[model samples]
Target chain A: MKEFKFLIAIWKTNLQSAMEYRGAFLTQTIGMMVNNFIYFAIWIIFFDRFKDVRGWGINDMYVTFGILASSFGLVSLLFGNAFMLSDIIAKGRLDYYLSLPRPVLLHTVASRTIASGMGDFTYGLISYVASGYFTWDGLARYILAMLLAATVFVSFLIFTQSLAFWLGMMSNFSNLVLNAMLTFGIYPITLFDGYAKLILFTIIPAALMGAIPAEFIRAFTWETLAQLLLGAIGFLALAIITFNIGLRRYESGSAIQTEV
Target chain B: MKHFAKYWSIFQITLLNSLAYPGEMVGRSLMIIPFMWIFYQLWKVTFSTAGADVISGLTLRDTLWYLMLAETIELSRPPLARTMSENVKDGSIAYILNKPYDFMLYQFSAAMGETIFRALVNAIFGGLTVWWLVGAPNHPEGFIIALPAIFGAWFLQFCLNAMIGLSAFVVEDVSAFTWIYQKLAFIFGGMLIPLNFYPQWLQTFAKMLPFSSAMYGPVYLSVAPSRELFISVMTLQLAWITALTILLIIIYRRGLTQLTVNGG
Candidate 1:
C-alpha cells in the first residue's frame, strides 16, 4: 500500500511536468494517435481488396490494433522508463533508484510518463468502439484484456532491456525487440503456422500481448483465458527474475554527479 | 566539374562511416527477413482466397518481388528528417551552415551514400527471403532497369524530408511531421501494397503524388519490365524531382532567415 502511494505520487509529478509543455504534449499525443490510425488504414485497404484473410477480417484487425495500441500506450505512459532502462543500466544510473527508499524497478519505471501514450490509450478505446463489439460485458473484457496485454508488453521490454546488465550497450538490440513486437503485434496470428506459430508463442510472444488477448475479448473461453493469464504471469515473472539477477551485477559508473 | 567533386567526397565519407559497424548494419538489415516472411504468408493467403494466379495484372511471383523491392527502398532510407531536426535542436545547424559546400547537396550526397549499403543489404535479405518463398523474380533485368529510378526515388525522399526537417527551425520538433510523412509514404508510395492493387480512383490520385515516383513506379518497372512503363515512370519522377527540388531550395532559403533571427 505504501509503495502504491509512492508510485502514484511519482506519476502525478511526472504528469505535472509533462503538462508544463502542454502544446508539445498535445501534439505528441495526437501525432501518435494519428500515426497508429494510419497503420490501420493499410488494413482498410487490404480488406477492401481481398475481403478477409482466412477468418480474420477488418473487424478483427480493429480490435487487434485497439488492444495493441492501448497496451503499448499504457506501458509507455505509466512505465516510460522501461523504454530507457538499457541506457540507465549502461550509464549506471540505477544508483539513483537504489538510493531511493522505494523498490528499485517499481519506482524507477513509474517515475516518468510518455505523454503520447494518452493518445494511444484514447485511440484504442475509440478503435474498440468502432470494432462493433462494444457491450457492457465486452467493455469489461476489453479493460481486463488491456491490463493483461500491457503486463506482457512491459515484461517483454524489461526482459530485452535487462541484457544491458551483461552487455554494456544493448539499446540497439532492445530497439530491435521493440520493433519486432510492434510489427508482429498488429498482424493476425492465424496467418502464422508451424514454426512461425512456435515463435509467436515463445521467443517474441507478440501473440500473448495482442492476438490471445484480442481473442479473449471477442469471446471468452477458459482455454483462451488460461493462455492470457499464463502469458502475463509467465513474462512478468521472467522480467522480475531477470532484473533481480542483473541487479546483483550493478556497479555505479564511479563518476559522481549531482541530481537535483 | 570542380564543385561536383565536393559532393562526391561527402558521399564517399558517409559511405565509409556507414561501414564503421558492419555487424550493426547487418543486424539492422535483417529486419527485412521477417518482413518478407510475413508478406509471403499474407500474399499467399490472399492469392489462394482470390482463387487466381493473377490479381490486378500481377502474378503472386510478381507481387512478392514488387513488395520486396518496395520494402528495400522504404527500409534502407536514411533518417534525414530526424538528423536535421537534431542539428536544429542542438544548435549545430548554425555551425554546419558556415561550411563551404551547399547544404542541400551535402545532405543529399550524404543520404545517398548512407543508403547504398543499407539498400543493398536489405535487397539481398529481402530478395533471398522472397525467392525462397516464391522462386526467383520474373525478370532479373528488372534490378538493372530500376537503377536510375531507385536513385531518383531517394532524391524525391531527400527533398520532402529536408522540407520536414526545415520545419524544425520554426516548430523546434519535427517528429510529428516525420511520422505523418512516413505513413503517407507507406500508403501512397505502395510500401505495403502495390499501387496496382489500389482502387482505380485512388490509384490515379496516389500516382499523381511524388511518393508514387519515389517508391512504387521504379519498383513496378523492375517486377514487370516494359519500355513504356520505364519511359512513363522516369518522366513522372523527373517532373516531380524538378518541382520538389525547387520547392526545397525556396524552403531552405526561408529557413536560413528564420534561423538567423531566432538562433541569434
Candidate 2:
C-alpha cells in the first residue's frame, strides 16, 4: 500500500513538472504527432506501391503499426525517465533515488514522463479506429495484447537500464540500442528470416512485441495467446534477474546524503 | 598556403581522435546492420514480383544491391552538420575564430578527416560484411565508376549541411532547423526509398534537388550507367557543391561580422 502511494506521488511530480511548461509542452505534443504521421505516411506509400508486402496488406500493416505506436507512446508517457536511467546512473545521480524512501527502480522509472507521448497515443487511437482493422472480438484480444506488450516494454527498459550498474556509463550505447529496437519493432516479423528472426525474437524481442501480438489480433487463437503470454512471462523473469544481478554491483552514493 | 597547413593539422587531429575510439566506431558500424536489413527486406518485397522491371528497370537482385550500397555509403558519411551547430552553441567557435585559419576551412577539414576515416573503415570492414552476407553489386564496374560521383555527393552534402548549421547566426534555436533538415534528408535525399519509386513528376523534381544528388544519384550511377551519364551526374554534383560552397563562405563572413558587431 505504501509503495502504491509512493508510485502515485512520483507520477504526480512528473505531471507537475510537465505542466510547468505550458507552451513548449503543447508544441512538443503537436510536433510528435506530425513526426509520427510522417512515418505512417512513408509506410502507406510503400503499401500503395506494393499491394501485398510479404502477404501483409495495408490494413494489416496499419493494425500492427497502431499497436506498436500506442505501446511505444504508453511506455514513453509513463516511463520516460526509465529510458534515461543509464544517463542518470552514469552521472552519479542515481544516488538521489537511492536516498529516497521509495524503491530506486520505481522512483527512477517515474522520475520523468514525456507529455508528447499523449499525442502519439491519440494518433494511434485515431488510426486504429479510422482503419476499421479491429473487429469486436479482436478488440478484446487487442486489449489483452496491449497489457502484455506494456509488461514486456517496461521489463525490457529495466533490463537495459540495469546495464548502467556494470557498464559504468551507457547513455550513448543505450540510445543507439533503443533507437535500433524502435526502428525494428514496427515491421512485421515474417519479413525477417533465419538468424535475424532468431535474434529479434530472443535478444531484442522486437518481433513478439507488435508483430506477433498483431497476428493474434488478426486471427485470434489459443496458440497465439499462449505464445504472447509465455514470451511476456519469460521476458519479465529475465528482466527481474538482470536487475537483481546489476543491484549486486551497485555502489551507494555519498551525494544522496546531502541531497536527502 | 600557411592557413591551409594549419587547417590540415587540425584535420589530422580530428582524424586521430576518431581513431582513438575504435570500440565506439566499431559499435556504431555494427549498429547499421539492422537498418540495412530493414531496407534490404523492404526492397526485396517490392521487387520480388516480375513487375519490378517495368517500374524501375531494376531486377530484384539489382535493386537490393543498389539499396545496400547506398545505405552503407550514407551511414559512413561524417555527421558534420550537427557537430558544427554544437560548436557554435558551446562557444567553441570563438576559439576557432581566434586562430589564424579560416573557421570554415578548419571545420571543413575536420569534417573531411572524419569522413575519410569512416570511408576507410566502411570499405575495409563494412564492405566485406555486406559482401559476405547480403552479396555484392552485380556490376563491379559500375561500383568503380560511382566513386567520383560519391565524392561529389559527399561534398555537396557537407556544404548544404554547413549552410543549415550557419542558421545559428540568426536563429536563437538552431535545433528545430537541424531536426527539419534531417527529416527532409531522410525523405528528399532518398534515404528511405529510391527516388524512382516516387511518382514520375516527383522523381524529376527530386533529381533536380541537391538532396537526391546526395543519395539517389550515386546509387543510380553505381547500378548501371553509361560513362556519359556518370560524367553528367558528376558535373551536376560539382555545380551544386560550387554554388553551396560559395554561399557558405558569404554566409560565414556576414555571420562573423554580425558576431563582432554584437560583441558575441
Candidate 3:
C-alpha cells in the first residue's frame, strides 16, 4: 500500500513535468495515436481481402490490438523506464535510484512517464468499443485482461533488460526483444503451431499479452483465466528474482550528475 | 571532374566507416530472420487458406521472395531524414553548408556509402531465410537484370527523404513527418502485402504513387521478370527521380535562406 502511494506521487510529478512542455507533449501523444491507428489500418486492409484466417477475423484482431496497445501503453505510461532500463544500467544510472530510501526498481521504473502511452491507451479503449463487444461485463473483462497483459509486458522487459547487469551493454538486443514482442503479439495467434507457438508463449510471452487475454475477453473460460494468471504470475516472479540477483552484481560508476 | 571525385570519396569513406562496427551491422541485419520467419508463418497460413498455389499471378514462393527483397530495401535505406534533422537541431548544418561540395550531393554520397553494406547484409539474411522457407527465387538471372532498377529505387528514396529532411530548416524536427511518410510508403509501396494481393482499384492507386517505383518495382521485377516490367518500372522510377530531384533542389535553395544556427 505504501509503495503504491509512492508510485502515485512519482507519476503525478512526471505528469507535471510533461505538462511543462505542453506543445511538444501533445504533438508526441497525438503523433503516436495516429501512427498506431495507421498500423491498425493495414490490418483492416488485410481483413478486407482474407475475411478471416483460421477463425481469427477482424473482430478478433480488434480485441487483440486493444489488449496489446492498452497493456503496452499502461506499462510505458506508469513505468516508462521499463523500455530503456538496459541503457540506464549500462550507463551506471542506477546509482541515483540506489541512493533513495524506496525500492530501487519500483522508483527507477516509475520515475518518468511517457506521454504517448496515454494516446495508446485511449486508442485501445476505442478499439475495444469498435469491436462491437460493448457490454458492462465485457468492459470489466477488458480491464482485467489489460492488467494481466501489462504484468507480462513489463515483466518480460525487465527480464530481458536484466541481462545488462552481466552483459554490460545490451540495448540493441533489448530493442530487438522489444520489437519481437510487439510484432509477434499483433498477429493472429493461430498463425503459429509447433515451435513458433512455444516460443511465443514462453520466451517472448507475447501471446500472454495479446491473444490469450483477447480470448478471455471474447468469453469467460476458466481454462483461459488460469492460463493468463499463470503466465502473468510466472513472469512476475521471474522478473523480480532475476532483477534482484543482477542487482547484487551491479557496480556503481558514482558519476556525479544533476537533474532538475 | 574534380567535383565528382569529392562526392565519390565521401561515399567511399562512409562505406568503409560502416565496416568499423561489423558486429553491430550484422546484429542489426539479424532482424530480418524473425521478420522473414514471421512472414513465412503468416503467408503459409494465408496461402493454405486461399487453397491455391497461385494467387494474383504470384505463387507462394514468389510472394516470399518478393517480401524478402522489399524488406531489404525498406530496412537498409539510410536514416537520411533523422540524420538531417539532428544536424539541423545541433546547428552542425552551418559548418556543413560552408563546405565546398553541394550539400545535397554530399549527403547523397554519404547515404549511399552507408546503404551498400547494410543492404547487402539484409538481402543475404532475408534471402537465406526465404530460401530456407521455400527455395531459390523464380529468376536467378532476373535479379541481375533487376539490379539497375534496385539502384534507381534507392535514388528515388534518397530524393523523397532529402525533401523531408529539407523541411527541418523550418520545423527543427521532422520526426512526425518522417513517421507518417514511412507508414504511407509501407501502404503504397506494398511492403507487407504485395501489390498483386490488393484489390484492383487499390493496386492501380498504389502504382501511380512514387513509393511503388521506389520499392515494389525492383522486387517485382526480380520475382516476376519481363522486358515489359523492366521498361515500365524503370521508366516510372526515372520520371519520379527527375521530378523529385528538381523539387528537392529548389527546396534546398529556399531552405538555405531560412537556416539558423541554434546557439547564435
Candidate 4:
C-alpha cells in the first residue's frame, strides 16, 4: 500500500513537470498517436489487396496491435524509467536511488513517465473496441494479458539494461535489442513458425505481448493462461535476479547531478 | 580545392568514427532480416491466397527481392534530420557556423559518409539473406541498372532530410516532420507494396513526388527494368535532386537569418 502511494506521488510530480511545457507535451503525445496510426494504415492497405494472412485478418491485427500498444503504453506511462535504465547505468546515476529509502530497482524503474504513453493507451483502447470483439470475458482476459505483457516488457528491458553493469556503454546494443523486440511484437505471431516462433516465445517473449493474449481472448483456455502465467513469472524472476547481481558490481562516480 | 578538402575531411572523420562501432553497424543491419522474414511469410501467404502466378506484374520471387531491396533503401538513410535538429536545438550549430567550413556542406558530407557505410553494410546483409533463402532477383538485367539508381535515390533522400533539418530555425523540433515524411515514403514510395499495385490515380500521384524517386524508382528498376523505365527513372531522380537541392539552399539561407542564440 505504501509503495503504491509512493508511486502515485511520483507520477503526480512527473505529470506536473510535464504540464510545464504543455505544447511540447501535447506534441509528443499526438505525434506518437499519428506515428502508430500510420503503421495501422499500412496494414489496412495490405488487407485491402489480400483478404487475410493465414486466417488472420485485419480484425486480428486490431487485436494484436491493441494488446501490444496498450501494454507498451502502460509500461512507458507508469515505468518510463525502465527504458532509460541502460543510459542511467552508463552514466553512473544509480547512486541517488541507492541512497533513497525505497527499493532501488523499483524506484529506478518508476521514476519517470512518458506523455506519449497516454496517446498509445488511448489508441489501443479505441482499436480494441473498434475490432467488434469486446466482451466482459474478453475484458477479463485482456486485463490478465496486460499484466503478463507489461511484466514481460519491463523484465526484458531490465535484463538488457543490466548488461550495462558488466559491458559498460551498452546503450546502443541495448536499444537495438529493444527496438527489434518492439518491431517483432507489433506483427502477427502466426507469421512466424518453428525456430522463429520458439525464439519469440522464449528469449524475446513477443508471443506474450500480442499473439497469445489475442488468442486467449478469442477462446479462453486454461492451458494458454497457465503458459502466460508461467512465462511472466519466469521472465520476471530472471530480470530481478540479473538486476540484483548487476547491482553488486555498480561503482558510483560521485558526481553530483540533480533531476527534477 | 579548399572547399573540397574541407568536405572531404569531414567525410573521412565521420566514416572513421562509424568504423569504430562495426559490431553495432552489423547489428543494425541485422534488423532488416526480421522485417524481410515477416514480409516473406506474408507474401507467401498473399501469393497462395491470390492463386495467381503474378500480381501487379510481380512474381512471388520478384516481390520478395523487391522487398529486400526496398528495405535496404529504407534502412540505409542517415538520421540527418535528427542530427540537424539536435545541433540547432542545442545551439551547437552556431559553433559550426563560426568555423571556416560551410555549415550545410559539412552536414551533407557527414550524412553522406555515414550513409555510404550504412548502405553497404545493409546491402550485403540484405542481399545475402535474399540469396540464401529466396535465391536471386527475377530480373538479373535490372541489377546492373539498380547500381546507379540506388545511389541517385540516396542523394535525393539526403536533400529532403537536409531541408527538414533546416526547418529547426523556425520550429522547436522537426522530428514530427521526420515521422510524417517517413510514413509518406513508406506508403507512397513503395517500401513494401509496389507503386504499381496502387490504383492508377495513386500511382500517378506517387510518380510525381520525390519520395517515389527515393524508394520506388530504385526498387522498380531492380525488379522490372526496361529502356524506357530506366530513362524515366533516372530523369525523375535527377530532376528531384536538382529541385530539392535548390530548396535546401534557400532554406539554409533563410534559416540562418532567423536564427536566435541564447547568451548572446
Off by over 4 Å in 4: B262-264
* Candidate 4 pairs with clashing backbones: none
Q: Higher DockQ: candidate 2 or 3?
A: 3
Better candidate number, 1 or 2, judged by DockQ: 1
* Candidate 3 residue lDDT tens string, B199-219: 899999999999999988999
lDDT digits (tens) for residues A157-207 of candidate 3: 999998899998877688789989999999999998998899999998899
How well does candidate 1 match the true structure, expressed as C-alpha RMSD? 1.7
For candidate 1, list the clashing residue pairs, or say none: none
Could you give candidate 2's per-residue lDDT for residues B1-264 as a string of tens digits?
764788889889989998998777776666566666676676666666434444567665566666666666676766666676666667776776798767778778888778777766655554564566557667878878898888887787778777777766654235444545666666677767777677777778778888877877887888777888787788888888888888989988887765522223
Compared with the true structure, what per-residue lDDT tens digits does model 4 show for residues A1-260? 99889989988888898899888778777877787788688788888778788788999989889888888998988899999898888788998888889988888888888878877877787788888789888988887888788888899889888888898877667777787787788777767889989989888888888888778877799988987888889889999999999999999967446755
TM-score between candidate 3 chain A and the true chain A: 0.97
Docking band of candidate 2: acceptable
Name the better of 1 and 3 by TM-score. 1
Scored by TM-score, the top model is 1
True contacts kept of each: 0.52, 0.21, 0.36, 0.36
lDDT of each: 0.89, 0.72, 0.90, 0.84
As a whole number from 0 to 100, the lDDT of residue B72 in candidate 3 is 94
